[model samples]
Each structure stands twice: as C-alpha cells, then as structure tokens.
Target: MPRAWWRQLLSRFDPTPIPDPLWRRALVSCPLARRLDDERQHALRGLSAAFLARKRFHPLAGAVLDERIRLLIAMQACLPALEQGVRCLRGWRELLVYPGEFKVRRSHHDEHSGVVSEAEDVLIGEAWERGPLILSLADVQLDLEQPWDGYNVVVHEMAHKFDMLDGPPDGVPPLPDGINRRDWIVAFQRAYDHLSNDVARGRETLIDPYAAESADEFFAVVSEMHWSQPGLMQRAEPSVAALLTAYYGPSPAPT
Candidate 1:
C-alpha cells in the first residue's frame, strides 16, 4: 500500500482522545475554538485529537511544552482543517516550536546571473512543502491572548500548508466539488494585483503590505484576516472574503 494509505490506516487504529478536562482547558485558552458552535466544536475536538495522534511535536530553544500547551496548539492548528476535514492535513507530520522568534538562513540563486545570495530572516512561523511546520511559542501564546488582532501564526502557516497541498504554494488549494477553480484564480489574481500595485506605489492598503510579496503570501495573509478579522477582510476585499468563507466555512472570529 501507499505511504498515505498506511498512515491513514494507522490513524484509524490510534484514535487518541483528548480528555474532557484537557479539552475544556484548551477551549479556555483558544477563543476561536470556544466560539465554534456545538457541532463545529465537536468536530474541532476530534480533529485536534487526530492531530495529536499523527503529528510529532518538538520543543526547541528552551521552550517548555506541556500537555496543555500541546493541546492548545493542536486546537488552533486544527481550526483551519475543520472545514477541509483531516485529509487536508495529509503529507506532513512534524511541528517544531521555538521559545520565540527564530532566524532561518536562506540562499537564493539569481536565474539571470547564476549568483547565489544568502540571507537570514527572522520569522514567527513557517511551513515547508513537505517538511515541518515551525512556529514561535511566544507568538502562539500571544495569538491566543489576542485572537482578533488580524494575526495568527498557526492559521497563516496552515494556509501555506493547504496551498502546498496541490503542489507548490500558488495562492490556491484543492477545491471541492462545486467551487469554480477558474473563478477562484481570476478573483484572487485581480485582488493580488491590486494589492501589489498599491504596495508598489506606496499607497495605504487595508490588507497587510507583506501580502504584496507574492500570490502565495497574499493568500496566506488574507486567510489570517478571514479568521482573525473577518469584518476587516470583507471590507477590504469582499470578493476574496466571500471566497475564503466558502473555502474555510464561516469565520469563528467576532465581527
């Protein structure tokens, strides 16, 4: 059998249940999860449990991770997967957590000149195509404390994971049966171009300026807005907001 099939089989057999007390504690820490309706809350609980079962968590840089912290992380991580179902989380199984912001050295080769340049970037969160999801534990805690501030490290990284599901991060994930793929591409492209142009001209933009970096970043940034500040997202880009609502179900954040 294929590796994915094997993993699915293992997941089916090992259904680790998140205890009631633990679940309640996690909900207290996670406003977004707490706001979910009874039905969605139940779904989130199951997804969180599955996430704990299938993924490995590593605490680095003196980060202290307890069971409750892990559960809290799982709860937030599973939120994006709620609408897409657990299958959207396929192809990855590790989460690396640092105590705070971390620096990563990256080398980029210029295609034109064939010269390689190396740089170190400080990041709160990052998701690789087929590698671990990395995060700063401090940022994660801050998001839990302030859930409506238009920033969520977990959700932003999760969006990239979903974007990479169909291949590379191209601002689009695998669509369901009824969602029009061409329409998604067109709407997102127009929105991305508009943001890019605004940023190029140094004009004020409602969406994050970082989103103007690329199409994939635009998708991830908008996704953060959808979950953390739905009202702002809708006001800034109603079309993109509507598409995200359709893709990820209704936002659990307060209006």
Candidate 2:
C-alpha cells in the first residue's frame, strides 16, 4: 500500500515495447545499436523502452527534444545497461538536455594553501549520483554521425552513473558474483598508472589522456572506447580491454 512498495512492484514489469517506426528510425541513426547482433539488439530495445518510461527529460537553454530525439537518447543511454540490467538505471530519474555545450561554475579548494578559486567548465555530458543526467544534444548527434571515433558522450556519462552506484565514482562499479573484484582493481590500477605516467611526461598515448584526470574518469573514458572503439582500446591496453569485454560483454562497434 506504500509508494515504495508500488514503485518496487512497478519496476518488476517491463515498459511497453517502443513503437516500431520510432525504434527503426532511432536504430538507423545510431550505428552502435545497428551493429548489435539480433539477440542483444532485442534486449536493448526493451531496455531502452524501460528507460523512456522511467526517466524524465527536460530540455534547457533552447534545446529541442521531440519523442524521436528522446528515444534516440534513451537508446544510447540504455546501451551500457544492457549487460548491467535495468536495475542499474533506477537511481537516476531526470535527464537535462542542452542545445550544445553547457557551462557550470565550480569552486576549487587548495588542499594545503587553504585557498579557494572559482572557475567555469564547458561540458557535453555529465551524470550525478542519485541526481540528473545532463547532455548536449549536438554532441549526441555528432556521436551518431561518427560512431567509431572512440568517443560517445552518452556512454561516457552513463559509465560515471554506474560507477557512482556503489559510492562516489572510483573507476569501479559493483561487480556481479564470480567476477573477482581484486582482479578488476589491480588491472585498472596498473593501466591507470601507466596512462598517468605517459600523460605526466607529455607522451602521446593511445587511450585518451583525459582519462588520466582520475580513476573514475579513466573508467568512464575507457567505457566510451569500449563501446565506440574497442579495437583501439585492445591495441592500447589489452588487459584492460579484456576486463572490459568480460564486464560489459563484447563490444558492438564495427570492425
């Protein structure tokens, strides 16, 4: 009889299948989804429908969002959750979309100097713990246009969301049983250290240097590569790539 009980009961049921025309149209626009084998593609469609049913979307700063674009966003946002399942999508309920890059003001505190500074950041996508998922519509479309470019704003931000599930983003999400947590930590730490060293020395590296920003960002960045350019990721860091494949299942990126 309680709201929580009702919500739990409702979560057990799958949302209605996405309308045929909309699903086909969105699928045509997104090569990553198009490339998925039939079975997984079937799962993705239902998961995406669940996403559209559960999450609320808000268009801000002159951004335009129709049902078609919303379905497109939902499809990509739910891609990372296919292996993880629909439960992982539960914590967040709102999505804020911007026309392009949106700016957020931040305050940085110096650890030893006791000084605080304020700055602004231009971001294309971001995810918050138990909060809203934000994105730039233009960049989302760009990712659809350039599917194999090793970057996917939706996947990158969704990775952050998954990482935040257990706690703050730590480059590690809660693993299902039988997957050794220690192995994940060791493999990711070694790869993160190597990338950080390369970045510090100003060496060009295969994995994005932006990953060196932090372990959590490393996970998110590699997640983007996992979905968009797993081949390149395998070439750059085979161990990490193997772990990712094991965790996220095989990449659907084009050969």
Candidate 3:
C-alpha cells in the first residue's frame, strides 16, 4: 500500500480514550501534565490510550502493580508516539518495565586477537530496533515527580525508535515524499559538525555534549531540545526544528 493510503486508513481510526480516573491520576503524578490544560489533557489521554492498546506492557522485578503506576508509564511513553501520530510506533510490541535501574552488559573484543571483554552499566530505558523496549520503573517514578523540563527518559528512548525507523539509529528517519533525503543528510551533518566543534572549542552548547558522541545521540538530543527549548533549537538549527515540526506538527503555544 502507498504511504498516502496508509495515512488515509489510519485517519479513520479514532484515538483511544483514557478513563477519567486514570487521566486525573496521571495529572496528579506526572508533573509534565501540569503544562496541559483540560482539553489538551483529554487529548493526551486519548493518545496515551491508543498507544497502550497498540503496545504490550510487561512488568518485571516487582510483582506488585496498580493502575496508576502503569498508566503513568503509558502516558510518558505515549507522548512522543502521540506527537508523531499513532502509526509512528506501530513496529514495536512490548514494554518490559523493571523495578529499578537494570544492568546492561556490553562486551568488547580485540579485533586482532578476537578476544572478548565485558562491561556493565545501569540504564533507565532502552529501545531495541527489532526487539522489545526495556524500562526501569523506579527511574520512571522519579521522572513522574521531577520538574526537569526536557529530560524525559521515555522521549529519549522513543527518539531512538525514530532513529531506528529508517534502518540503524543514524540520526534520520524516512521523510515524506517531497522532502529530499539528501537535504536531510546535509542539514543533520551541519548541525552535528557545529555541535562537535562547540564541544571541541569548549563553547556552551544548548544541548548536552554527549550529543556529539554519535549521530544517534545527536538525533535524540535534538529531539529533547525540540520540546524543551524549541526557541533555542529553532535559532541554533532551524533545519532540525523544521524536521521535527514536519514529523510532530507545530507545538501548542505555551499556556
């Protein structure tokens, strides 16, 4: 089927609506919800419901569970997916939530000797391209009450999903038919180079320096900037902002 036809079909589907109690609980627990008004809150609830209905949630570590906790996780995870539209996250299935920070092991190999070395680190959430999403419930709870404007673990992980959409997480996704893929490459490259130079020169970067580490990180950091500091993102890299807007639509005016 053509992209236009898929979109048209999806348009006919109504966004799932969350129950009133759940929406109220989400507003109480998640500080991010404070930014939204009544109507927007309902809209968010609807989007979140659609996401929960589409994706599976797997709770690990803690056997104890409640509706509010799960809804909290769903709301945050769904925000980015909702912003991009329901079909954006269609490929993924389950969300495996751990009780706290979980250890992820990484192995290094000496290319010449072909010997392997291993290391581990704790993480909040990770998205696998063709696999399930891993999340830390404890970290998610911390995020619920915290007031950090742009530091959303859910959005960060979902950004990786966007990066992975085209193939590997290489800082870009498939553009609409008329948009030039070459132009996207140029724009992202220019922004990436600029960020790298700023880090090298010890200049203040609007986003974290970790963004300079890789194209994937660049995409994720830029995504955070899009929602957290849109004005700054627009000024520093208009093309990035344009790309985000093209995908997510214009953000609602600050209320």
Q: What are the per-residue Cα lDDT tens digits for candidate 2 across 14-50?
A: 5877889989998899888898888778777877888
Q: At residue 81, what lDDT does model 2 achieve?
A: 78
What C-alpha lDDT, on a 0 to 100 scale, does residue 140 get in candidate 3?
Answer: 73
After superposition, the stretches of candidate 3 with alpha carbons farther than 4 Å from their true spots are 1-16, 31-43, 63-65, 177-179, 252-255
Scored by Cα lDDT, where does model 1 land?
0.90
Alpha-carbon deviation at 96 in model 2, angstroms: 0.3
- Candidate 3 structure lDDT: 0.72
Better of 1 and 3 by TM-score: 1
lDDT digits (tens) for residues 1-255 of candidate 3: 223433453476655567787777677777665565555455557667767777777878773447777778777665655445555776778888888789999999999999999999788888899788888777677766553555667767888887787788898776666567888889899999999999999999877788899988888877766655667778878997897766654444241
- Candidates in order have lDDT scores of 0.90, 0.88, 0.72
Candidate 1 local lDDT, 65-128, one digit each (tens): 9999999888888888776788887899999999999999999999999999999999999999
For model 2, name the residue pairs that clash.
Answer: none
Query: Where is model 3 poorest over a 10-residue stretch in terms of lDDT?
Result: 1-10
Per-candidate TM equals 0.94, 0.94, 0.81
Off by over 4 Å in 1: 1-14
